[model samples]
Target: MKFYISTLGEFDIKVDGQSILRDSNRMYRIYKLFEYFLTFRNKKLLPETIIDNLLSDSESEDPKNMLRTQIFRLRKIINALIPKGELPEKYMNLNFTNGYYCLEIGENTIVDIDVFENLIQKGDKEREYDIESAIESYQNAISLYKGLYLSDNAYEVWLVPTRNYYQRLFLKTLNKYIDLLKRNEENEKIVNLCEKSLLIEPFEESIHIELIEALLKIGQNKSAMQHYEYALNMLEKELDAKPSAKFINYINIIQNYTSRNNDLDIEAINKSLEEELPEGAMYCSLEYFKFLFNLQKRKSKRNNEYDYLLSIMINSNNNKSINDVFSVLKKSLRKGDVFTSWNDNQILVMLHNVKENGTETIKERLTDNLINYTRINRNEIRLIFQPVSMENTIL
Candidate 1:
C-alpha cells in the first residue's frame, strides 16, 4: 500500500495512486486532524495541546473525547483506502502512547511537504558547487509548492508559522536561483522564472525589480514599464508603501538610459512646462501626476515642509465609477491638496503641509464620508499613504 499526502494549496491524500478525499463528501475536520498529526509527525503531543490547536473556538466541551472519536474515524478512512494485511499492527496507524497521539508513518508513505523540504536541503547543499543540479532541485521543490501550505486552512493559527516559514524559504530559493541565472546572463530564462515566481509572490517587490531589469536587458522596455506600473500600483494599494530606493533608481536609470541631458535646471524647466498644473484636487493624467510628483519633491526640498501622497483605489468588484469616487475626494480634500488619476481604478492625492498624524485624521474623515454617502462597502475602497522626504523621489 502506498500513501501520498499533499498539504500545499489543497489537502489531499492518495492511496495506491487513487484519491480518497472527495469534494461533495469531504471530511473537513477529520482531514484537518490528520494533517495536524502529520505536520507534527513523530512528536509527543498532549491531548490538551492537540485540542487547543485543532479544536479551538469550537462549542464542544468534551474535546478529548471528540479528538479520540476523530482519530478512530481517521484510522477507519485510512484502513478502508489501503489493502488489508498490507502492514503490521503498528504501521499505517494513528497511535496513542503515554497520553500522546502520533501518526506512525508506514515505510511506503510519502508526504509532499517532506519531499519538498528534502529537495530544498539538497538544493542548498548543491548550490555551493553545482549550479545546474541545484537549479533542478529547486525547480522540483518549487513545483511541489503549488500554492500555500493547506491554503484551505487559512486563518488556522497553528498553520501560520509553518506557512510563513515555507513561503520565505521559497522566496529565498527563488532569489538565489535568479542570481545564478543572472551570472550566466540568461535573460530569457530570468524572464520566465520571474514571471512564474510572481504567480506565487505577486507582491514581492524585489522580484518585480528583477523582472523589470530582465525585461530591459532583452530590449523589452515597454513590458518593463508596464510591470513597473503594476508593481507601483500593487505595493501602494496593498502595503501603503513604495518600492525601495534601489528599485526606484533602477527605473530612473532605465528611463534615462539614452539621455544626454546632464543639465539639471534645463530638464526641470522642461518637465515643469509639460505638467498640467493643478491648484487644488484637480484631475490630471498619470503623466501629469508624475510631473506634479517631481514638483512636490522640489517644493519639499526648498521649504523643508512635510507632505504626503494618498492613493485611493476602487475595488473592481464594486459598482462605483471612477468619477463617483473622484467627486467624493474633490469635496473632501483641503484647498492646497492636489489630486490626479493614477489609473482608471486609482486616484493620487498629494496632501500638502500635513504631517503623518494629520493623514490619519484625513483618512478617518474620508472613510466616514465615503461610507455615509456611497452604497459601496468600506472594503471596496483602498487608501494608501506615501510619505514624502526631500532626500527621496516617489511615483
Candidate 2:
C-alpha cells in the first residue's frame, strides 16, 4: 500500500488514499510519536534522545517505560493501516536493537518534505542552463509550502529550529524564483508570487519590498503606495520597530510617481486634496504623526505657541476595546488635534495652541468623555501631558 505523509504545514498520513492519522486530543501523544519517527525514519535514535525530546517536561517517574508504552500503542496504530491479511512487519517496522530504536518504512511511502527538497535541488541544477524549467521547478516547490513547517506544533521547543530552517529555505528559494522572473521581465508573475509569499511570510521585510517593487514595475503606483502604508503599519505595530532604509526609500519613489502625473488640472488636484466634510479631529498614521509633531514643534518654537502632547495609557484589563477609546477621541477632540495609537494599550494625541490651564481642562473633558462613552472607571485610564518641543520624542 502507498503511504502519503504530509508534515510541512500539518501532520497527516494517508494510506492508499485513505486518511488514517487525524488530529484528535485522545491520540495526540501517539500521533506525535508517529510524526517524530516518520520525520527521522530509518535513523537509529537512542531511547534517551527520544525521551529527552518528547517527554522532558513530563512528571512521570519512569519516562523510559512511558516511551515503551507509547511505542507499543503506535505499533498498533501502524498495524491497523495495513491490509486485513497482510503482515504489518512487511510494510512498517518499529524495532529496538542494541541501545537504539528505529522506524523503517517501505519504499512505497512518499513524504512531502522529501519531495519539496528534491524539487528545490532540481531547480538549482537547472538554473544555470534552463531558466524556464528552473522557474517551473521552483514554483512547484514553493507551492508545497502551505505554511510554516509543523505549524500546528508552534509551541513545541524541539520543533523551533526545524521550523526556522524550513522557513529560511522557503524564503531563499522564493527570492531566487523572483529574481528569475525579474530577469524574464515577468513583472505580473512576480507581483502574484510576492503577494502569495506575503501570506506565508507576512513579517518578511524583503517580501514586502519585492512586492512593492513589482507593483511599481507594472505601473501600479497607487497599489504600491497602499501596500507601502500597510507594510509600514504592520512593521511598526507587530515588530515595534521602524522599517529599514530600503523600505523607507519607497516613499520617495511613490512621491516621484505622483509628481510625474501632469494630466490633472489645478481644480481637479485641489478637489482630490480636499477632505470630504472635515470631521472633529484628524487621525493619522504613527509615521505621519511623527512628521506632524516635528513640524508643530518647529512652528511652536518660532510662534512661541503652547502646543502639548497628551498620552492616554489604557489599563490592560479594561473591558472596552482600544478602538472604542479611539472612536471617542476622534469625536471628543478639536478639528486641529491629531492622534494615533502609540502601542497596544496607549494612544498619543497632539493638542495645538492650548493655554497652560487648558491642559487640565482638556484632560478633564477627555477623562469625562471616555468614562461616559466607554463606561470604564476613571482609574483605568491615565493621561499625561507635556509641552510639544524638541525635547519631547513622540516616536
Candidate 3:
C-alpha cells in the first residue's frame, strides 16, 4: 500500500487513512516529524537532534527519555490504527540503529511541494517553455498548500530553511501565474490572484505592488490606492520601514494618468519622495516604532548604559522577520512580532518562578542551565557560542 501522511495544515494530523493523531495539534506535529524518518529509513537521524529542533525552548526536559515515552505512546496508537501488514511497513521505516533513529524512503512520493518544484524545474528547462503545462503543474502545487507547510509542528533546526524555501516558492508561483494572465491579456484576473498570494505572504513586495497596478490598469484607481495604502501599513507596522521607491513610483505614475489625486493625494510625484532602501527592505515611520527597554536597577544603571541601550537595540530588532531564527522568542513574543535578541550569552532555563525573578537573576539562571546542558551533551560536540550584544549585532 502507498504511504501518505495527511496534514490538516496548521491543524491536526492523520496517519495513513486513520485518525492515529487527534485534535492535539503539537502531538500531531510530532507524528508528522516521523514522516521524515519513514521516508529516509536508511540513515540514522538522531532523536536528540530532532528533539532539540522539534520541542520549544521552554521544553528543556531530557528528550532521550521523552522519546522513549513518546514512542511508546505513538506505537500503541499507531498499531491500533493501522492494519497488520501495513503496520510493519510503517514501523520498520523507523529503525533504532547505532544509538539513533535512521530514516529512508523511496523517491518522489512526497506531497505536492515536490510536485510543483519538479514542475518548475521542468518548465524552466524546456526550450519552448510550456506555460500551459507549467500552469497545470502550478495548479497541482497550489492545490496541496492546505494552509501553511508544516505550520503546526516543530521538526528540526535545519528544516526551517527547507520550510521557508517552500513558502517562498508558493509566493513565487503566484507571480508566474500573474505573468501568464498578463500574456493572455487577462488583466482583471490578476487582482484576485494577487490578493490570494498576499494572504499567504503578506510581506512579499511584488504581489503587494502588483495588486495595486492590476487595479489601476482596470480603471480601479480607488481600489488600487486602498490596497497600496494597506500594503504600506502592513510593512511599516511589522518592520518599522517604508515602501521602496519603485512601488511608490509605479503608484505615482499610475495616479498621474488620472484627473485627480483622489486615491494617492500628493502635491508632488512620489519619485521626488523616493527613498533609498536596501533591496527587500521597506521604508517606514521611525518615530512611531516602540522599543521596549528593560527597567534597570539604579545602582547598576550608571555603569550599564551600554547594556541598557543594547537591550533597546534588541527590542528594535524584534521587527525584523516573521518570528525569529530559532522559534523560542517567537512563541513567547506577544502578537508574535519580529523582535531582536538580548545580546547576552543566553541560557534555556526551566524555572519555577520565571515571572517573579529579576533580569540579572533570570540571566544567571539561564547561564547556569545552559552550561549544565552543554556539559551533559559535551560528548556529542565541542563548544559553540552566539553572543548577542549591540557591538556585534546587525539588526
- Candidate 1 lDDT, 1-395, residue by residue in tens: 66788887678888767887866546888888887887788788899999889887779879888888888998888777667767634346777888887777777778898888899899999989999998889888878876688877777889888899888888887887788788789989888777766666666788888888888888765556555654565465445677677766675765663133324567654653333232325554576456446645654644476778888877765555676777777678764566777767877887767864887898888888787777656887788887665355457
Candidate with maximal lDDT: 2
Candidates 1 and 3 compared by TM-score, better number? 1
Per-residue lDDT tens digits for candidate 2, residues 1-395, read 67788777777778766788666798989988887787678899999999999999999999999999999999888777777887655677788899899988766667888889999999999999999999999999999998777777767777788788888899999999999999999999998888677656677899888888888778776566656765675476456788898887777776555545524566644542343223677677786577557656755654577889999999857556688898898799986788888888889998877976998899899999998988567888899998887574655
Candidates, ranked, TM-score: 2, 1, 3
Q: lDDT per residue, candidate 3, 153-190, as tens digits?
A: 54555556656776777777666767776777677778
Q: Best-fitting candidate, measured by TM-score? A: 2
lDDT of each: 0.73, 0.80, 0.47
Q: Candidate 2 — worst ten consecutive residues by lDDT sum?
A: 269-278
State each candidate's clash count.
0, 0, 21
TM-score of candidate 2 relative to the true fold: 0.67
Candidate 1 vs candidate 3: which has greater lDDT?
Answer: 1
Give candidates' CA RMSD values in order: 12.2, 13.0, 17.9
List candidate 1 stretches off by more than 4 Å: 15-18, 88-91, 258-395
Weakest lDDT window of 10 consecutive positions for candidate 1: 272-281
